[model samples]
Target: MLRLRKSILTVLLAVFTLLGCVAGPSLSAEKTALVVSVPMEGVVGVSLENYLDEAFAYAAEEKAALVVIGLDTPGGLVTSMRGMSQKILSASIPVAVWVGPPGARAASAGAFLVMAAHVAAMAPGTNIGAAHPVTASGQDVPDKELSRKITNDLAAQMRSLAEERGRNAEVAASMVLNSVSLTAREAMEIRVIDTVTPDLPSLLKWADGRKVRVGTVDVVLDLKRYEIRTFEMSPRLRALHFISRPDVAYLMLTLGILAIVFEVLTPGGFVMGTAGAVMALIGAYGLRMLPFNWAGIILLVAGIIVLVLDLVVGGIGVLSLFGLASLVVGSLVLFRAPGGELLNVSVGFMAGITLTLGAFFILAAGAVWRSTRNRVTSGQEGMVQGEGVVVEDLAPGGFVSCHGEVWKAVSEGGERISKGTRVRVVRTDGLLLHVRKVEGENLEEKGAGHK
Candidate 1:
């Protein structure tokens, strides 16, 4: 609940910063300027890479006065982050990277991007630093030589970005080397960032006449323009971003299986099957976009197949047991990419899902198999040897009340029976039942109807 509130506040701050920045100014006084505000949130990925390309291109072509980016991210791929920084560096328009909404922090790769911007700003509650590199598992590089190499290279990167932006390069190096961090106020005091802003109005007002060198030309920012246009990513990107989280993506894949299972359980249904297929596809796409292990996927699928077969073919807990093993092994290594700890899913979550699904399949299938072996308790065949009261006298064949139903009965033992006398069924032929008297006498009646 707290996370949700934080996210909402961040969004509001970003939106207000863009829309209300430099307000109270006459837009028509000078030339009309288009200010493009782009929100860059979440972990960096191919989706982010594409969004950046689109935003930067549009801003350049439109000749916007300001490109305000509301950035709140934990950090992501170094490669993607580097490409984004390069895009900002080469852009003809000035880029303002703002870490905002009080609780927001630009750690790791985010810090690199923040320092690379032409104008770096932050809200009071935000912090920036922790540019150290770790493996996908969130551990220092196991190889000592490799660890030193990556650290030095990354430190160089931080220093270059900070120096280029005219910020504090030494402090930037410490962020990478020592995993140091600074609040918005401290960062500004140390000259690591240009300024601190409480809100969008203050940021824009402060930024009004700042001159920034873009490529080969020095451009002066004019914030007199009142029009603020926000460019959002495509719907496709939005969908991808939503499922990019390790937990959500994993759930999509696992839940997709249950949907398909339900469809199979209730065959010929269209909705569940289609939904399962689509969810699985989207989940698979999300995995492919991340650092993925194909082996894990194959094992996971194989486990599901085995479990399904066990249910269908009535395996005595054998196939399902093996399936459980496969699931456990596959899940552990599923998202173990190069630096997978950054995108790690909880072990408890994976184990619980696996156990729940396995147990359900085993219990439900075993119950069904047991039910098929139970004795037949209904129909005419079950009525053999059942005792009934005679409704009419039976000389050879007459109606007898058998199992609460009137049946055309014949005396196979050649016994005479009176009306209301109890008789036991001997056998059945078509709709007729052969009977004998309770006294062991042969019952016979001439009439078919007993009245």
Candidate 2:
């Protein structure tokens, strides 16, 4: 019994030792990887908003180690830029915004976003800064009070972002208030950015072993050999981006107007009506997304009505001229911004549209004039000089065969005409035709013969 007890104790000790070895505390650090790329080009719009939303949502859900935004933008709407900046500041995970790929820039709103990120980086040959605000059409507004207010607000925002991220607050403020720009090396030297990397691999390599604070808890990053995941915009969001532009909305509106005009000109074509309806709905929706001037819209509508009336009615001297002038004025005021950048319609485009509309009117008016001047080809007026045979009766009024049809006729000379008398048609009056005996024909003989 003692030998069996000893063997059981040894086995239990060995099993416990094996378990301890397998479940021991790991010495290696835990590594995490999260990459969010925002490669925005041209003007910032709704697309950028959607893309940012998607990327942040993914990052928040994944509890990513770090979110990296590959930014390249030429500034955008102030509202959108501010919203993006707030999103970055509120992120639980450390966000790294890298302006990269050589020759890439983060201008205007981009500068604000970069300042907001926990870790801002730039690639060689890249530049950042230039945060001046402007209208949609790239026109600069000269409101001194408004400009001052915007500059102060943006400068404060940049300073806050920079201070939070341990970047250069003064330099960032200068960027907003002075429109200063810096290359990658210059940005890094001035502490506007954390690092200047040649490529993504270098960026990740440099990011390794860095530490960032998350709500009073300092977390050490270990991103070596980490996996990267990218987030893309949804189809619906992409479509919204596509149609949210002023130019796109203008094009849609033009298409709608043309479609409606065509439908009116040629009724009963279901295709034209349907197309007009669809285009108009789309245009209205798109225009609603933009900042529009109601006055301009009213003018445009009135102009269109006048032009349509000119087509329907015979006169065009007053209404047509007024309509053309209204159209020009409405087009000029369509965007309603003092600056040229916010203008949806260019002078060239307006001129072209006006010229085309005038040409169309001229052609249409010519056609109407020609049609009004054309000679009659059918009816009694057409048959006034045509030959006809007396089909029946022998009186001042008789039945005549004209145009292979029988017609009630009367003699203009007040003379009796007989059937098959071979009379000559003189004139017609309200379903009655006047006739005379053929020259040198015996009218009395013909009348007696018929009887």
Highest lDDT against the true fold, candidate? 1
* Per-model lDDT: 0.80, 0.73
Residue 41 in candidate 2 has what lDDT? 57
Q: How many residue-pair clashes does candidate 1 contain?
A: 19
On a 0 to 1 TM-score scale, where does candidate 1 land against the true structure?
0.70
Indicate the worst ten consecutive residues by lDDT in candidate 2: 337-346
> What lDDT tens digits, residue by residue, belong to model 2 across residues 206-248?
9888898766777777787577776766788677766766566
**What lDDT tens digits, residue by residue, belong to model 1 across residues 167-221?**
8999999998898989999999999999999766677778888898888888888
lDDT of 2 at 409: 84
RMSD of each: 14.1, 6.4
lDDT, residue 419, candidate 1: 82
Candidate 2: lDDT over CA atoms? 0.73
